[model samples]
Target: MGKRNITDEEIGLIKAMLKRGMRNDEAHFHFNRQDRLISPGRIAQIKSGKYGGDVAIANDTALDQFLAESQQRSGAPAKAARLSGPDWGETFEADGGGGFRVRGGETDTVECKLSFRMNPNRFAEVVKSIAGMANNKGGMIPFRGT
Candidate 1:
C-alpha cells in the first residue's frame, strides 16, 4: 500500500493517548495504529509543554503531579534532540538491540514500541505501520531487524 497520510482523526487519537498518561512504549503502539510518529522523547516534549500546539493545557498541575508521582519507574530512553534541527528527521540506534530511539536531543522522546518481531516480509508491514507514525511525528527507526 502507498504511504498513509496523517488525518485529524489520527491526531485526535494521539491526543487521547496523551490524556491517558501512556508511557513511551504504549504511546508508540498507539502512534503506530494512528500512523503518526512519536517517541518517548516526543511524548515527554508534549508532557513538558514544548512540541506541538502553542497553547498549554490548563491542567499543568495534573501533569506535574503525574510526572512527579508515577511509581512505574523506567530507565531513561535515549534521545537525539534534533526535532528542530536539520537532521531532526532521523532516529538512531546502537549495534546491539536492547533499546532504539527516534529523533534526539530531547528527553523522554519516542519511548513506547510496537515490541514485536517477524520475518522479513512481515517486518515490512511493521515498518510501513511505523513509517506513517514517523511521518506524523517526524523521526527515523533505528531498531535492528525491525
Candidate 2:
C-alpha cells in the first residue's frame, strides 16, 4: 500500500482520545467500544516503537503533538511484542512511566512517559531508542526533566 496517513476523521478521533486524558487501558475500552480501526494494542505498540508509518511530524507545543513524538521514540515497535500485544489480553500498569502510544491521522507513532524518577542509564537508553526510531524514518518525543 501507499504511504498511509491519518485522515481528518481519524485525527478527530485521536484528539478525542487524547482529550480524555486516560491511560492506554482506559482509552482502549472506549475506542474498542466505538469499533474503530486502531486498537488499544495498536496504541501501545505505536507508542513503544513497535509500529511506524511514513509521515513528517509537525512541530507544536500541544500535549498531543509532543506526545506523538514521545510515543514514536520510547514506545515499543509494531512488530515487537507489546505489553499487551494479543487481542484477548488488555491490562497495563499506568505508571505514566509505562509509555503510551497513539497513531492515527498520521502514520508516525508517538510515545510518552511519566516516571517517578529514573537514573542516567535508563534516560540514555530512552534517548538512544528515540534517535534510532527517528533515523529509521520514525520519530520520538520522550519527556524528561519534567
Question: Each candidate: what lDDT?
Answer: 0.46, 0.43
Q: Cα miss at 145, model 1 (Å)?
A: 8.7
Best by lDDT: 1
Off by over 4 Å in 1: 1-59, 69-74, 77-120, 143-146
* Winning model by TM-score: 1
List the candidates' TM-scores in order: 0.28, 0.23
Question: Which consecutive 10 residues in model 2 have the weakest lDDT in total?
Answer: 100-109
Q: Candidate 1 lDDT, tens digit per residue, 1-146?
A: 24434333443444455776655555444344334554546556555555444443435455444333332223223333544455433444442566545433222334334454678756876677577656555554333343
lDDT of 1: 0.46
Whole-model lDDT, model 2: 0.43
- Residue 109 in candidate 2, Cα distance off native in Å: 27
